[model samples]
Target: MVGKTHFIGLMSGTSLDGVDAALVSFDTAGPLTGELVHTAYLPYPEPLREQLLAIHLPGHDELHRAALLANELSRLYSRAISELLARSAMSAETIEAIGCHGQTVRHRPDAGYTIQLANPSLLAELTGISVIADFRSRDIAAGGQGAPLVPAFHAAALRHPTQHRVIVNIGGISNLTDLPPSGKIIGFDCGPGNLLMDAWCQHHTGQLIDQAGAWGAAGTQLPDLFNQLVAHAFFSAPPPKSAGREEFNLGWLDSHLTGTESAQDVQATLRGLTTYGITHAIETHCPNAHEVYICGGGARNTALMDSLRAALPGKLLASTEMLGVDPDWLEAHAFAWLARQTRLGLPGNLTEVTGARHPCVLGAIYPA
Candidate 1:
């Protein structure tokens, strides 16, 4: 535990796109530092993606279905890890552990439970490495919204000494971490990110993603639709809150639409809603924030990023890469760091951020 140790992190976010794997090294004796050694991504097949999307809602024989999917997901995760190690010319024995943030089919922290479908024992067996999974339940048990656990990692990796920096992760759901020069860190889910937009795009255009947000960028935002979309109670709720497809999904969007609006305009409005949510969160909570760094899949949406820049004038907005971490892989890297925390018996949740009773070590272990 004295020198550098390597770990692999895997994340399949709310977007339900695929698994992202990151191999990282950290120094055990100093302040937490993650040095990225390798990364890999494996997109879920169309059928697998459909099954995962269906599992998010109440359904028939879901328990059996979920169990089967968990084992399948473990194999997929193992493949991602194998790709990472192979590309790096390393072996499973070289890694200390694999931190896997499994597919979240349900995340209702208010109900005192969150389910992230992952078969860590299978993953450990498949990869021949120790596995750490289910990193959120402890925080929820401590009376917190277990979603958005990445803020602790954000603070450790991106906090600025003299500047108030905000890190906004725009995944299927958007969340921000307020890293003030001197104060308790603040973080929570802002609102929908790419989930609705992607859903809408796929439904109308047959494309899985908006592709740089070109389709939306070519359309015009509808004022009334945008207002209604942004008026969701989740956006106005106080911090220490988290959200998922349960809160904002195609069903939610369909209810807001009149069924007469132009499809492209609706797409444009969804993009606007995402930009407004993130900007409003920063303006209301981190008014004096010096710089804003964005990560996650949504950061790849050019139109969304442009809208954010336009909405928040005078604030320097850029990708997390400005801070030396790739935006697309930051979350995956965080899980690796979280696994290290668990291994070292260190607290990983930030109490102020998650509204937990106190900081706690997160995740369960499956030894190889």
Candidate 2:
């Protein structure tokens, strides 16, 4: 297969943040060597965030509105790509393809489906590049968690043979990839990551996120409440599971909070819950990990980073900086790599990690 040296991967994570556009450069053949050369995050306009938050669980006018937003998302994605190319002194003609992880409204892997909201066909037409999207359903059809597929990218792009390592992506929902000293690679969504914390921040402070986890740092974790939250079956369930806003969303918070605590207190508990869940998973699954490499939106939380440090004492906890990849762009870069895989018809899932009956090529291609 003929390959291109550049691609644009788009990520509109569960956080409902604006699309994260990454310009990835790669040889896209033989042994995968690639880099997210340039990255840009465009925040969802205020109105769009409200619209997404409103329709998320209840689905009132959302289905109709979602269709509208889907196209709008496509336009936004196209614009981001155009802008990124412009900033990099490139053009649409220079890109090979676009890998877009549409907005994820629901991710029910057990039910044999996962939903990422975006119109890749429209994106393809608008950007004039082949698009690869709908990345989760095939895995789910194989009886696997369609979510957390990034581990495959993590292993290929970040793993080291001699140094046992873990790639922890703390996005709206947190997930981990355990790259063993050998060839075994395992991963799963540990539990709520920045999703819950971000929700609490928005409600209380009118901010998209808790900058530096400042609010959480002011409060203490309510141990009983923390345990109650962790009792969620997702934490106890084995690997091969994936979660999104469906399992841990705004309504999820309302049910858990139940009018007993302030939002700040709730935020503190939520933060504790994520760290506890991640540290526990590491201790259980990858006890030998030499270090934990942090990525995703959660890596920006200075206080959250401190908490993770305290939770996993004596273990080196650092962002992806040392690895020469920015924490913010890892997910976007993963999708870019997946697009390369789709073009090559390569299997993107580890049968061992997702419990798929067989390794299968992931994602569908949209014509330009």
Candidate 3:
């Protein structure tokens, strides 16, 4: 029988808020089973965050800026990995590989390219461990969206034999994974999660995020604004679709506003927009899923969670924690699992989820 193997996964998601690193162990010989062993996080310094947000759009000397930022991110990733190893009391050599889902600055599968900034060679050099990075491009090349990649991991870790389950990852952009008892897996990017809400909150209040959606909850939702926000074509687009800052960002939100709405009301409406996006998707696509598990930053938003519960009556709404993985670290854990898949020459993406022409082994490896 094959022994258990360990891999470290690092993720700096669309929020561009911080880096999350998780160490996970998996039994290589049998059905997929993952044990979360250790984890660490490091918030982006304000300036770094500002730079990353800026580069999401076109700018002067972008190539130079992106290249430099990629190196900086590699260093940041190395630091997080070091903390994870130290906390776990393990050496770099003891782990098989590092899965780093670098900072995604652009995701445009329709145009046939997605960019995730990471100097994996630098990360491998700094951490003295093999690094697997850029897990999206291969899927895109195969005529796919190259996103919501977690569905494959979701199936391996969360799917049930008899229960119709849905995993909702409420990151900067929300995505859904439907796990049916006896059918093909379905998953896609739903719509706005924390992306617009966080942007609007920062613009009006200078806060990084709404603490448990308190600001939005205290205010009333703007029906007109909510209607307008949901009117975006991406929200209604069919699956095999994905989104990022390019599709839903401050610029798009600004264009929708009349500039007369109260900041808090807009905040409330944005929260409503997020809640609608998730619940609507569930009702439309995964109607049979009675058990819904949420993860990522948005899962922590009390108002958002409450809204979801109220909207989806009769469904069991809970965090991924009930499944033994903390909501906050599930994405990070996925990358670790993906790293293991890449190392073993296994497919890491589900064609059904990404709409790829075929299942593909994702990511490129940088040797230690």
> What TM-score fits each model?
0.98, 0.95, 0.98
Q: Which ten residues in a row have the lowest lDDT in candidate 1?
A: 25-34
Cα lDDT computed for each candidate against the true fold: 0.92, 0.84, 0.92
Candidate 1 C-alpha lDDT tens digits along 198-255? 9999999999999999998888999998888888898889898999999999999999
Scored by Cα lDDT, where does model 3 land? 0.92
lDDT tens digits by residue: candidate 2, 80-169: 988898889987788888888898876777677777778888888888888999988888888877767889999888888688889999
The order by descending TM-score is 1, 3, 2
How does candidate 1 fare on TM-score? Answer: 0.98
Of 2 and 3, the candidate ahead on lDDT is 3
C-alpha RMSD of candidate 3: 1.2
TM-score of 2: 0.95
